[model samples]
Target: MSDNPMPSSFDGNPEFKEETAGQKLRRRLREEPLIPLGCAATSYALYRAYRSMKAKDSVELNRMFRARIYAQAFTLLAVVAGGMYYKNERQQRKEFERALEARKQQEKRDAWLRELEIRDKEDRDWRERHAAIEAAAKEAAKGGPRPAPAAAASAMASDQSRTAEAPVEVSEEKKKGGVLDAVKSLLSGGK
Candidate 1:
């Protein structure tokens, strides 16, 4: 009813006097482009990082970090233990092989010593029997008393073959042929 138009509802509110978000942003970009550009870049980086985040809750984040740490520690421990175990096993195996070799050498020496002892006993026995035979022959040449038949027979019976000085006929083993002959023999079924 008045000559002047009534004031709008927007004009009555003080909140409408404040600059809008888009107006403020445009004024900041136009007035100081470098600072706003730097701020925008930093904000964008933070936004991207937030968007790419896997764990939302602090509890979940802590659990994920703990699990990763535990897995890495376990893997490291297993690698170190495995390496030490292999090294220790190799050392033990080497020691065992060395001990086995020493034992085999000792066994060979023992066998050789036994063989020598047997040879020495045989030689001594043969010498004593030879001396007895020589004495008996000398007594016969000197027309001395003869040995008792029963005693002489009993003494000679145990080793009569060994006491004899007859010529020995040694049979030699046949020499093996080369690979070609062996193959040929095999092809011919051992002929």
Candidate 2:
């Protein structure tokens, strides 16, 4: 006879086997049925699904955080650029206002200068006309109607002298030489 043991028919047919040690323990645990083993298995599977969802949520949160940071940076850049542009515009406006004020002041000054110039010209013309009238009056005062040719010539010569108003005769003592006159005389004598 062979020394080998016979192979059982149950080992060849896996579906016809009795409960194992582990299956017996599980059945004993499920006897009270506080929470069935199947329910516990499903709860554990749902917990694993929740953990996967939490991980995906964390990835999305990180992407949102990066986008927020980029948005903040761009907002800061826009604010600074707008502030600079406003400052430049304000300065330009101030310069334009200053130029306008200067132009107004210049126009006022020019108007004043033109007025003074016109007044001065009018004064000069009036003085010239007055002097002409005075000379004609003096000529009419000096003569009778039509003197002799020789007398008329002499009278005309006298009239010329009278018409040219004589320099005011200051006293000789008042007309004493100044320091400049003395120096000029001394220099001329030496020469």
Where is the poorest 10-residue window by lDDT in model 2?
Answer: 2-11
lDDT score for residue 162 of model 1: 57
Model 1: per-residue Cα lDDT over 19-104, one tens digit each: 56897678646644554444454455445445445436556555545555555555566556555656854465455546556656
lDDT of 2 by residue, 1-191 (tens): 52222234323544332456897567645443433433454455455556656778766555555554555555566556555656854465455546556656767765765454444444444565568556656776886344356864575566456434433222421254333334445646945
Candidate no. 1 TM-score:
0.37
lDDT of each: 0.54, 0.50
lDDT of 2 at 113: 50
lDDT for position 177 in model 2: 34
What's the CA error at residue 31 for candidate 2, in Å? 81
Model 2 alpha-carbon drift over 4 Å, by segment: 1-85, 144-191
Instruction: Name model 1 segments beyond 4 Å from true.
Output: 1-85, 148-150, 157-191
